[model samples]
Target: MVKAAFKVRHITQRYLRPPGALKEKDFIGRCIRCNQCAEICPNNCIKFFGSENGADSMGTPYITPREKACILCMKCGDVCPTGAIKPIKRELEPIVQYVEMGKARVDEQLCLSYQGKSCGVCYRACPLADTAIKVGYMEQPTVLDACVGCGLCERSCIQIPQAIKVIPNHLLASQLKATHLKERRSGDNDVQIIKFK
Candidate 1:
């Protein structure tokens, strides 16, 4: 059972939630599966997981940036009857601070800019622009702390395998915890423990 659970976690594709969504555990409990977030999304980026995704995820709103990246309009949160998705203002500061959909990671080897092709599409597509996705040396995208993981960069990426991807916070937290435990058990000195709570 433990091995099966670990295998599922390892294989599951991390999905970005709507802006202002609570942590996975809390969101699952609070969400009423009303589909309000999906209906209110102006960009129509929010979609519910089907039965094949499993009972826990079925009917929960998730965004696949490859299909449609969030524009960060905050309308989904505004229409949420429950606080599963917290209501946030449509301002820059609040959105940056409160909206943590995921974090974007870049694969330097596959990036066009890193290949000397000078691609800046990801930087240009980012709504936060200079703050979230900045163009660094050789026009390479530098994801900054201001990134709210709206996945505009991933959506705009022209790379075949996608040079950039957003790692959902829930999955990231669990992975980090697992790594920390593994490192602790091995007594690895280089391990940087990060507590999720």
Candidate 2:
């Protein structure tokens, strides 16, 4: 079991996961999931959880904006002595250099555009120097195929609420799913739906 755990950690690290592939940034991203960011959050936006996902990031933590968007509040950043989550002026900087997040996806079924109305707020809001998100004539207006799931659409949606969001990579999310199945068979007990607590 120890060897198996080591292998999982080694593989996850091998992937050079998180904080992007930029080596310079990874230096600041060696987070041990200490929950400092979550704890310091006044808005209770940052959240973490035990690894029901896999041995790799088992007990690993992630931040879900839905708990509360960063607001660029800087509480997490100020408390992050290790610089795990950087702080920046919400208006002046990109906040999260979005491209580093991952490729974006537009679920047509859930998207307002696909909801039979021509709402193109996302395209207009997306910062378009090398626009990762854009609009195209898809017989129905659809987000450009080049979208990098950066949550911009979700953040900028004006449909009385958000209509888009950044999402974890489909392949990675599936692998975690498989890990869950494996864990269930091992009978370590209790499966609970994790919430953003």
Top-TM-score structure, candidate number = 1
RMSD of each: 3.9, 10.8
Deviation from native of the Cα of residue 95 in model 2, angstroms:
2.6
Off by over 4 Å in 1: 1-11, 189-197
Residue 49 lDDT, candidate 1, scale 0-100: 79
| Alpha-carbon shift of residue 17 in model 1 (angstroms) | 0.8
Worst 10 residues of 2 by lDDT: 13-22
Using lDDT as the measure, which candidate wins? 1
lDDT of 1: 0.83
